[model samples]
Target: MKISRRFAGLAALLVAGLLGTTVHIVTTAESADAAQTSLRAADPSVLRVGGTYVGVQSVGDNGIAVRQASSPAGLATAAARTVFTDSQRLGEVWAPEIHYDGGRYYIYFTMGAGANHRMYVISSATADSGYGGATKLNLPDDRWAIDGTMFVFNGQRYFVWSGWAGTTNVEQNLYIAKMTSPTTATGSRAVISQPRESWERVVGNPFINEAPEAIKDPNGQLHVTYSANGSWSEQYCIADLRLRAGGDPMYVWDWYKSNGCLFGSNRSTMMAGWDPTLYVNGPGHHSFVLLNGDINTSPPAGSSFPLMFHAVAKGTPYAWSNRYWYTGSFMWWGAITYSRANVPGSTTNTGYSIKFFE
Candidate 1:
């Protein structure tokens, strides 16, 4: 019954190839209930414009598939259309994120057939059209990089990504640098996070901490969420690091890791309503977006921030094909408690809760 992690990934891929379908069967009503509670599935990176929502997913050889709709419900049913493709990039394009800045939309993605992965960017005039050719992002060094995302803080634009410390592939860490422009880096890169914690060092790989996504809470504190562990294992999960409002982002000492993972595989049996078989598996590689309004009205209002990340079915083979989008709102109570309610611009003493679909 002992299976090697490498073999497990291979076996999952082989099964996927033979089955010719990505969907897995749910054997029980409890599993079905879990699926229903989960967000609509996709390999999603989502953005909302006015009333319309747009998303992009990794499509292997066909390139990044873009989907759009007026509502999240409609977006679930919308057919994907190929938006950006480079015949020269002879491999998979991974984790494409769409962002709007300076009167244009930009997409940051990872592309490579194998070990030589690098972060690339493309520009578009609108939210979902006129995308320009891809260009390699100007990093401080040209080692290996991926999962690049951008954010603005204190009126300065910055880019954050997962990259190798050197030419070697032994370790992957999260780095941030000031951006001279949307597609270029201006200064030295800061190594924000590495796989230093036991929880971050998953079984298959001791050196991982990739897929960085940035979010600014209402209090103006900066939070960066990144995926940890081997991407191919059920242990893959999301963790967070935080910086206070006036903290220096370039200073490594200014940021603090969350007490524990923000989301991931579950082993606990405390929840009476949760079937252990239906627990979320490998939930990481995520992006965050704020909803225009509350989706739940029963509590008068709910948090608008929802996390879009990929997860696999419990007990399923850990193949890339098995990864599907699942989103849930974040509970800020843990963050507040961890920060001792010192989060900026907050006058309340209440904790926040995530509103999952019923």
Candidate 2:
């Protein structure tokens, strides 16, 4: 099994402080348009130092609830809003991966329906405003799906998630779908990885593989990671696929599971935690935030927020235990790094810059 993982270099983190430095913009197609509402930026900042955040129970039994610190150095504050609270129709919304691209913010998350959950897209002219209604993509064959993450490789975008090859639900496989747009997918959902492998299997409910997150290294290698086994004792694992410049991303996503678990259950450099989460454990399902501070500053902006789920203490390194949190809840941001470092094959040389539209 091939896995592509990168470790970043030790560099200073910078916080932007110039006026006009902050911008909020959102644009979308007409038919799917919903009311536009302004989102509030929590004071003190939720992603603070030594703070804790916990996911709020559903107010009306719908949508994910998130809370965090107000300042980079303060106590966590709480807040909630229904992004997609139509339980009778959409059911529970989970794991929202927020992205900022092309002057707009696109939030990709899993929405539940009846016994199955599929991925959907919501947009806001601004990163932290009330997003318009969602557009659900018809996942190939309508297999039970969840944990949808949007990724861009070599200038092209793709969606990766967990689903069953057939309807049995006994085997949840990792699949990728090509995107015609942020809200729609073209072509069939291709199977990238399956739980049948010895390293991918687990024992319990939802018994299978799920939740895939992919990122590229400075050398342009693609690293995809996901969680397997039952949710209660969930395990986080990673694998790799390579994409050459101008190569079809779909073809580049060939499946090959990693050698072992990156972090989960009893194995990991980081302590094992349920949800087998990532991207800075916060208010939602396995999420990660990339705050690309100025290349010359220290402790970059958007660096802290409250803890989530279990309400543990914050202030540890961003990659500390499963208890840190952040409050931006929603906001517009940008990163300016040319390539990712610490990835496998440090000797390989390749570089590219990424500018996402949510």
Candidate 3:
């Protein structure tokens, strides 16, 4: 498998974490102006087209912004030509990730409020035309699900999302199922990852393992990154997992996780009541993009890749406006395998310690 096109874009996310290993990462713009993307960022998602960064984000209750981000940091500032709006209950429509497949653009987003929140999709031939009429997927295990994303492996389409294990909300877990089409799931969902780590379960009662994003390494291994903890708190962070070599993705025994959070809270120098942007908090809900070069070309060992995400200035409430978009680059350590998936999760099949930006 080649790299994810999502990785082909510029750094479109801001994440925080210090994996216990010597990493050759270039993380800049650690401090950013929060007011820029304010109500526009919550679950920020974008795709790079040529030199332009195109994205869709929550505008407000019942609204969406089909945005042309001027830069990774310049969301909400760019053209708002691509958008979706409805008076019908879209209650805090969040995590709008855009993907292009078969020469078409598809926006996968979460809509509705509370338990009513579920994933939906809209498409347009070109982003300039704007997406229309959100449609929910016919999922077999259709419970409370959100942050749904799609990936294709060996020509087979698959859907991964964060959902409640039961009817009532207890905790959010990562699930994968076969997708007959972009808008339909064809089989029972397999539970892959959950909030088993203490850092992942920090407060908000119901722990989270949301925002399952897929990325491919140069070696053709399949891996996914996810957000952990509560988004409402500064404790919110990012973690990841990978499929075992030659392991069946549908089986719970096929996936493994890192020892700890791959991306979490950024620790930086601070003064008393430091600039909110100076020390970012809870860098999560992000997507990956290949910094440069052709997506099909296998980058040499230790090539730097960019990432972007929404973050709040330190000491600020986790409000919509407080959250801003940030960008940076990190180097990959190739396919070097040292540590193992020492952490616990749904499967006993521990994998090689898969590190991101290390």
Candidate 4:
């Protein structure tokens, strides 16, 4: 990847470990100020959801300024919009998920450039609109990374994100570390899993494997799923990392796959899936809600319940390029599906459902 002093100078890590490893923390008053100011300058009331995706286009040089969308899906389709954008005129927003906890709405998303991406959080009064500005999380490295997802387990919050080990783009590992506070880090980072398997390492330039999302199984076990391969080539794919209930998410763990491409097309066969986000619209990132009703609370005999997830993608699954940007590449928003066919009901799963407050 291209390197610039401006980018390298942004790293902040103290007391490097034995393996030339360190956790980069860049939480500063200035960055925090920028986030708050962004929220105050913009009219938070303007953002609302359209039918398919959230609709809030940027004015003039701004890109998609107010993104509001309607949610027919169970997740309360609250109105949302961008409270701020940097002077660079490039808006890097992806898969904005709102989680309601302890009577608060936490907005989580990935922000930053190619390899130097970081995850940030902002709070809001409600699940949809009136969101506060983002406070940058102090992650290990400040390099090419994005797609940081948040999950609450057993009353505690944990963060999962994709990061690179070195300047070389050969490896992208999924990491899980405990947050000391709701938005800060405390414990040592763990390399939960890497793209060592053949299915994960796609054949292409800028080889990568990242974008991890995790959900607890009915048995209280953790099933962490992430995408593998190049974002621009056909090697993009998705896989799962598994950990038992008592196991730590920070340690290296073995994962399971669906035995095939969770979602892909006839382009490069494997490397086509990017940014696999999961939500409970009834289905998941791989499945959509065909009908609305009282879902069967119990699994059937000799079989697992088929729970669906609601999701949105930065790009299409099988296509080599994107359509909207028209640059032979780009990311868009949409949905996908995954079936909890074999997972038991008591596994601590998110219930293939969503709860939102308007």
Candidate 5:
């Protein structure tokens, strides 16, 4: 992996202000429409520190677009500068996540045209530039895989993702493996989550559990939130799996599945009653980021952690092409609470009683 020295200074500056600074922005009715227009259907991942951010947008082999923003809200306005396109493998790229570890920035994503899907990694010296070549991660089994992300717990790094349980795509399950390095897996992979719940299984397709994203709460508890139901169904949504502190990530029995969907279709009274002006549907396939502060500047508050996902417009047909980027804030119970109204400073009320910025 190529390491860049420029990031060392920026990283230090970021760490110093990460927990102390709050970002505030005011949105008008027009700004909401602008936000919706900027949204995209792919898995959106962003790394934000103070006013600087690096976001990953999956736009195929032309290489993923790595955009830079001055502030968290500015992400929608920043122009993208493409990277890693020249080195991508023969197929398309999907779900790219950017991480900074050990003085280098690593990008993990899924690649391949069809049933040949697999996870690949590339490195850069800085968060926004100098991307190196791509390398396939070493998985014990070579079944279909996608939406790979990494998290560190107890000082050990682990890779988690959704993959086919067998050669056929009859079923998809969430898996984890310890990492020997940023681009290599060690030992056997453990099946952490599968589609056993009735809501998890789609009518025409195999059971699904994909788009795994790891989040650590204020109490230091570890949780992996994944998308369930079929991606094509309006019922497609997000769910959670919790791991005890210092527990074995490689053991399926060590993770506990939360009750019900954390975020899904219109199950809440607020969502079911949404007005046409404030409607969003099929909210899933998400990643989380901690915005420095609430979007409004008047109320100086602590960090605002929100889930970034894609949703279809209120009256649009449910299709991948119709999905666009949207964000919703969840109250931190022992797990995430997504069914409630807007929290004080973190979320704004959309018509559906969903506290998300559409």
Candidate 6:
């Protein structure tokens, strides 16, 4: 049986404790969305460094956990082993993202409870295999931060994450700052995007804008997709921010918020597709591996992008513990607009559309 090489990379890594037959993402919509595995882990991030595949997650309240695979296909069977847990057990350690650059691997995550939350990083020569002690990332103002992710744009490295503006537990806004090094962020943080759209302000205690992920398209548009609304609400979904042309990356006015969530609750009718999961809600806090064939590692032609996120199963009576890991095969249609019922004029090249695989 011929299987997709791109889909194979994420299939194994997400199935940690479950058993499943080999499957691909190119099948009918029914099989695609039905092919989910309940990893029961939050804030999943997977990175392929050379031939090694490493995944980091907030498996527990104390610290970061890791699972590795020697091959992309081996990710399906790799077992999770906690690499870092707070000895002091300070607060809920959530949204740990693993990134690689300059021959070193870095894992950035949040530590401490509520207002005391701060972004921290730990690195090893390898990908968290020999991870050392955690070092608090030095951000300007040292505000409460979480879900720190790093990306290099225009030959300079930059850091982005969800953080509070002041000392209060007010709204969480998406912020960008220049990173002098992977472990430290330099320059003042720029509040690029926040909860402004009506859909973004849906279920709010403090109006959310957390879990910022950076992706750059072929057009040089630095796209930052963040989660909006309350994390536990069924309205918990993914939204976008694109750095406009001739715009400075660090400037707040340079970024334009997209019209809607890339993928929202099935009840909201964001993207058009068959509902294979019975009830799928809160698809946010994701990590994406784009098989663009130029950077990182080259792949065969027709390789697709993989977006993995945690989502709650049912909408009514939203429960935090009910969230599980799910992945979508991201397709790029270039200049063609996706002809979906609800998402008219949506282009898969920009707007979000995915085919779940079983």
Q: What's the TM-score of each model vs. the native?
A: 0.76, 0.57, 0.78, 0.55, 0.76, 0.79
Residues 128-163, candidate 1: write the lDDT tens digits.
678878898888877688888887777788898888
TM-score leader: 6
Model 4 alpha-carbon miss at residue 209, Å: 2.6
Which residue runs of candidate 4 sit more than 4 Å off their true CA positions? 1-80, 87-91, 254-260, 266-358
Which candidate would rank higher by lDDT, 4 or 5? 5
Between the candidate structures 1 and 4, which one is better when assessed by lDDT? Answer: 1
The TM-score measured for candidate 1 stands at 0.76
For candidate 5, lDDT tens digit of each residue in 127-191? 66788778888887987899998877667888898898788888889999999788889988889
After TM-score superposition, what is the CA distance of residue 269 in candidate 5 from its true location, in Å?
13
> Over the stretch 1-358, how does candidate 6's per-residue lDDT look in tens digits?
4344344345433442244322232222212343335477677787665456677777667877777776333444578777887987788888888887777778889999879899988888865478878898988889999888888877788998898899997788988899888887887899987786777887887999999878764445576778888997777887667665456888876666655666676445353322223446777887774332112231113444555677776644567787776755443212212221332222233332233332
> What tens-digit string does per-residue lDDT give for candidate 4 at 144-228?
5555666666656687777776655666677777876667776666777656555545444545545555554334555555555
After best superposition, candidate 2 residue 35: deviation in angstroms? Answer: 38
- List clashing residue pairs in candidate 6: 12-75, 12-76, 13-75, 13-76, 32-356, 32-357, 35-358
The most accurate candidate by lDDT is: 6
Q: lDDT value for candidate 6?
A: 0.67
Worst 10 residues of 1 by lDDT: 23-32
Tell me the alpha-carbon RMSD of every candidate. Answer: 11.7, 13.0, 7.7, 17.6, 11.4, 8.2
How far in Å is the alpha carbon of 87 misplaced in model 2? 5.8
How many angstroms is residue 96 displaced in model 5 relative to the true structure, after the best TM-score fit? 1.0
